[model samples]
Target chain A: MIRKWSIALLGWGAILGLLAPMLHTIWVSFSPDSFLTPPTNVWSVKWYLAYFGDRRWIHATSQSLLIAGMAALLAVAASAPAAWSLGKLTVARQRLLSILLLLPALIPPAALGFGLLPLVYFTGLWGTSLGLVLVHATVGLPIAFLIIRTCLPAKLGELEAAAAGLGANRWEVLRRVTLPLLTPVLLAAGIAVFVLSLNESLVSIFLATPTNETLPAVIWPQLRYSPSPMVAVASCVTALLGMIGMLIVIGILGYQRGRLIAKNTTAINS
Target chain B: MQRISSWLPVFASVALVCGVVMAPLLLLLRVSLYEPATGRGFYTPGTFTFANYAIFADSHVLGIAGFTVLCGVAVATMVLAIAYPLGLFLCSLPPRAQSIAVGLILVPKTAGLLAMLFGLQRWLPRGMLATIIAEVYLVLPYSVIVIYIQLLNLDPTLRDAARGLGASPWQVFRRVTLPLSLPGIRLAFQFGLMWGLGAFLGPLFLGGPSETTLAVELHRQAFEYGRWPLAATEAVGLLIVVSIAAWGVPTVAQLRKVAHS
Candidate 1:
């Protein structure tokens, strides 16, 4: 009984600890006057208005969305085929290949960010959306690879073989069968990649130029120098984007679950 | 023809991985060996030396590396301590409650690190304590999720058998549950350790001057000083430490499996 109570307390404590920062951000986002004074009942969307009114903030937000969207697409493009191929390999080879693919993610972001600098400089991609997209996509690759690799059914090889025996060409098998089965996993992987790219700050901070400043890069300096309610507002907006991405993930997962249940029921009835 | 087509993807992916991922890392390693040039030149083109690594022999730089490792170990331990119980509790909850719990955890993870750090700065006292707290906060969700999944996958029969034998809950946890969950715990610890080692924002916002980590120094050298060689050396050193920790867990597990067999 005591152990159970302690576990419950710890659980709530952990949740509250996770939430306090977000709640504070929300609080300050509303209470713009609290920038000078202690937080109070006085609330307004003045900071949100301020965030929108500023042209730089608007530019940063759009730039972030563009980079994240492009990165997500590129990440899926890069990882899907790799993951599909990896899933077909022997377990030993799959493990080795997976580790190699994930090695970039394991490298400290600081190192990866600095390492890419020379390339970015040489390629004249410094401070460009294209440069950021390439870097973000590389970093987002591991997550997409892991998701797709796991989602690819182990029995897929047999299914592919069966399809091939039925005289379906490779392209025909992929388009008519494999791709359809992978759509949910692809959507989930895309959402994960988008959220990761959207939340990414360290690499963005290193690579951001004035014209390509991301939302986090724009807000980072403000946190250090100004420390205002406006930072809180921007934080809230970033969190909202992440939450929306996660909601899409949850919806996809729930839909997949419903389909599995329906399929199982139909199997039983038939 | 079909065999060739299948091998084509393998060839393409390997080439892409090598070009985008491995090539830049090689560039970093090469740049680290290049001697610093006079004036604004970051490194001489032809010259190679260990001078960049020699710079790390300085007490100041060594101190930063030492402190960073200490913080990483501390954060990993602390996160495990907090998140293990939290995971247990989460597993005990109904599916709906677990989903809500997980969503709350994902908020900080998916939200911007700077944004979350900014919020933490307003509430916590600035220094080492706050840095640890924030680092653990950043990784706690991951640890919990890993452990919770492990718990869910655990065979209930073992726990029931232990209970049926008049074993106390504590005994069941210590003997049956903990041993079973060790792999997940170790993986979580590795993740927490890696996050702490690579930590930048937490140390930047929450920590004082004394808490300046190797990552902070690497950023300073690369950006503020334009000393790419020195920064690359530091980055390589960090990479070595992180790679060891990241790969060490699986290797140990592999060895353990061998021993069992």
Candidate 2:
């Protein structure tokens, strides 16, 4: 019907509008000129080469990877146990606790950055990787919690109870039963946490120092005023890492869903 | 013993929340009451005062809070408007098509906020318009997902039954679909508003000085001016306002549910 077509038209129009900036970023990053401008008469990898040729950009990239990795590990460690225990709660309790865990995300992250700026200085971790890692973990924990919690099987208690009834002790149940079941969920949460921390800008603006500066911190200043292709190149690399992270998430989630469907169909057939 | 043992694992999450999040927040609250340094440190380390909050009483500071709230509301409304059609359309598609639609839509958000904003800063014009547009873009993905998930949960049988009963499509939507998805739409609006309040990157990266929200002001005070006490004041103020605004959210949605039924 005409209505359906019009609605589709509107939806697609909105999607295109939303995508405009990212597309522009990609286009601008490839600008053949040393300085960035629109109406790209040509395309070149000069910026990409420039990024590779520069020591600071490469150092920033490695620093970002190291920080993101450590943060993700810490986040998943905290998130997995929390998610499993939350799944054991009654629905009402579970909902309330999840919201409590999510409170860090709901508030302005500027608040966290402001708070951490002084705390880190006091703790003697100011501008250190240790400081950024701890802060990133705190910020990424809510998302990591949500990811693992959602991906967890609904019958978590039933499964754990079944294991315990079969003579597994608490530690045994956790080690032998709970962790295996949680592997994929933990993986998903870990990657999600890593990607978020990698592209993180807000807290990094406050925390990053000369030695510990991440790609976003490096990209931040260069983005101001008249940006060059080098800035675009850095942005493009960060953007690409984000897309790669999304693909990994989709693959893991899809595989999990596919397995669940297969199990359901097999049960029906048998 | 069993109940106590069962609670042991939950303690890790509780510890992380309390230790990493709440402790620093509490510390910030304490720091807000400190005497700001005139000559030496981030603040006078131990001296306590209410002077930072006194600055908040000034009309200039109050204007920033008011402007921030207005921006949040504007971004929320605009994001919801754009998101509704996409949510409806995505939910209408078949499973594979639905996934494709979602995947396509996530491209901007998945590219990450910093990169996307860098692009937006270049493409969009400056000032409040650019800030709003970028915030809307930053928020649209989440809003659409909220609405789509809500709409997907509706019973298609109700729509078919409405058509069978001789209601027009518009009537069916107004009578059935609209009523059912009102909760989702409300949730989307609230979610957008919460995120808009937290719209630090968009405004920071793209907006002019006149577009200074409370979040940006907090950043300016802390980093730019080295006024930790003033920044902590802005942070605490932002938290109180968001909590107060959010209190009315569930009630409005609940009232809508009653009215529709």
Candidate 3:
């Protein structure tokens, strides 16, 4: 009974702790006064109007979406071949290569971003939207690889071998056998990359100037100065966007899981 | 298996992508050697000097790096401490309850880190304590996810047999469970440390002036000061430190794995 109570407490503590930040942001969003002042008034969306109506916020939001969308596409495209190679091929030094590819994910973005600033600035690509997209792609690559790699079929090698054993060539096997199995994971990976790229601030900070500022960069100024409730409004919107992206990914995963079960059942019957 | 060159095209493309991605970072090493007067002319063939590195070594950069590693260690220790008991508790829960529990832990993680700062900043006392609290909270879910997976992957029969032989719960945990789970624990610890070190926006917003982490310092150097060389040197130094830690962690983890095996 004591153990059960403790576990229950742990679960509740985690949930409450997580909720604390979200709730506070929501509360402050509607507050009549700024920092350290007691909030009055029932819930209001004035800050939402201030954030949505602001030209800067609108521009930042659109830039964020464009950068995030392009980054996701490029990252997923870059990683798909690597992930497929990792899942389908058996070769020497594979593990080392995979680890090397994963280094960007392991390193701190601040470190990487700082390193990139000089090089990027010199290349005439600094402060450009496309440069920001490339940086985002680099950051998102390992995550994209990991997510797609996970959902790869366990029997991939067997299927490839069978296809080869029959009269089918490599291209035929790839087009027919492998691509179908890999599509869901690719979508999931894209979604994860999209969400992460969208919320990204650190590298974007290095890559962005005032004219090219991402939402987080713009929102950051609000935090340092007289923080308007609009900061909270932006934070809430950002959180909502991430959650929506995650839900879509999870929904796809659920569908993939169902198909996996059906595949297993069919195999058992055969 | 027959050696297949069929995948070479794919491998080469991946390598090319990684190479392009790495170009800017690789340039940092070159910039670190360039003269400070060559500011925006970073690519110009200038006399190489150690002035940038010397500057970084003199500034609070060294102090920032020390604090970063220290905080990372502290947070990693805290996470392992919390995760072990919680992982055990998770194992004891029913499957449905376990899923729900895991989901609740992960929800905050997916909500993006901005929510994490905004949420915790509201109720908590600010500065290092709040920063630590947020870092611990952010890292906990990941640790739990890793540990829970480890626990589930473990052979439960050993615990069952130990209990069957009249061993107490404490003995089973101490002798069988804990000893067997060292590899997983090591993995969880490494992840926690890495996450703590990489944590940017958390330290950027939540940290006090006294707790200036290397990550935040890197941001200041580049954005605020436009001290590219200083920032690049510091970033490179941080990479080296983290690389050593990253490299050392897996070796230790593998040794533990071998011992356990």
Candidate 4:
């Protein structure tokens, strides 16, 4: 009993540590005073108001959202078919291909940023949202692939074969069977990719120009040079979006798991 | 003919991955070898030299690499220590509790690194300690998630049988749980180590001048000092180090599995 209590305490402590930064940011954003000094008055939304009043911050936020949205869509599109292919391949081939796909994530972001600079310049995509989207999609592909692949039913091939035996053509089988089954996982993967791309700073810092600064890029200079409650407000906004994204992902995953459990129970009963 | 069509998506994705991902990396490697010209742009064309790599002999560069590696190892060790117990704790919880715990832990991870670092800078003192603390916070969720999944997938019968055989709870954990989770632990350690080695923001925001890491130095060299070849060299060096650490752990784990089998 004592051991269990201590373990629970440890878990709570870890959670508190994880939440400290986010909570502090939210607190300071409303404190209506300097971070260095305590608030003498009631909480206010002055900092949040300040964040919205700044056109640069608004531009950064919209840019980040647009880029992240495009990246997520691209990652899902690229990885879904690849994941389907991987599921059909031999185990050895699948492992090799998966690793190859994951290579973008394994390397240091700085290397990728430095390496892509010349390519981006030569392709005339430097400082463009399209370039960042493409890079972010590549970075997000691994996670998206993993999620989609995991959600793919192990008996997908068998199901396809069965559908074929029922006189369904390939396109019919895919459209009527495979695509429907994949929608939930695809949504989950898309959300995960969005969160990853939104939070990605290292690569964005290299790729972002003054005209296309991302939210994190905007905050980076502020954090480095000038610290203020405005930074806290920006942090709060990013954190809020991230948490909402994660919560939605969790809900989708839970629903998927529930359906799987129900199917398994029915299979056992029959 | 139908079979050929089915392979089209696969081929297209492979082509996309090669064009978008592999090509740029190849570019990075080529650019690293080119000679850098001062007062010219990021790189000078039509020249190659070993002189760029020779700059690693500078004690400052060596010091930064050594410090970065040391910090990586330190962060990896600390994260594993903290995450191991937390992983076990999370695994022991009810499903609802486990999910809640995981969601809370993932906030720091999903929240932008700069945002977290900003908050941390205000909360913690600047130095090596602050960098480590922030990095640990950044990486703890990953380690815990990996280990927690490992624990969840473990065969309950193994623990039950061990207990039935008169093994104490501690012994069961040591002899069964720990050994079984070793692969997950190893993976977490590698990830933590790599994140630490690639740490730019942690040291940038939370660290003092003296705590300058290899990543930060690479950035400074390339952008601040206009030394592209030197920065590329450092980037390549970092890549090699991280690749070894990333690949090394898994290879060792596979070897151990083979030996055990």
Best by lDDT: 4
Give per-residue CA lDDT, model 4, range A1-270, as digits (tens): 997788788779878978887776677778766664425578888888888999999999999999999999998998899898876677887888888887777777777787777788899998789988888888888889888888886666776777788899989989866776678889999999999888888887777898878898888878887888888788778878877898999899878875854563354336
Ranking by DockQ: 2, 4, 1, 3
* Model 3: CA > 4 A from native: A32-41, A87-92, A163-169, A261-270, B1-13, B38-45, B56-59, B250-261
lDDT of each residue in B33-110, candidate 4, tens digit only? 988876668778889878888877989889999988988899899999988888888888899988888888887787
Candidate 1 runs further than 4 Å off:
A1-6, A34-38, A153-167, A258-270, B1-4, B10-17, B247-261
**Across residues B28-104, which tens digit of lDDT does each residue of candidate 3 receive?**
77777766544564333656777778855565676887888887888889888988777877878887677666666
If both were scored by lDDT, which would come out higher, candidate 1 or candidate 4? 4
CAPRI class of candidate 2: medium
Interface RMSD of each: 2.1, 1.7, 2.7, 1.8
Better of 1 and 4 by TM-score: 4
Interface RMSD of 4: 1.8
Q: Model 1's chain B TM-score?
A: 0.89
Estimated TM-score for each candidate: 0.92, 0.93, 0.88, 0.94
Better of 1 and 3 by DockQ: 1
Worst 10 residues of 4 chain A by lDDT: A260-269
DockQ for each candidate? 0.55, 0.64, 0.50, 0.61
| Model 2 lDDT, residue B8, Cα | 77
Interface RMSD of 1: 2.1
lDDT to native, each model? 0.80, 0.81, 0.74, 0.82
lDDT of 4 at A167: 90
Could you tell me the lDDT of residue A113 within candidate 2? Answer: 75
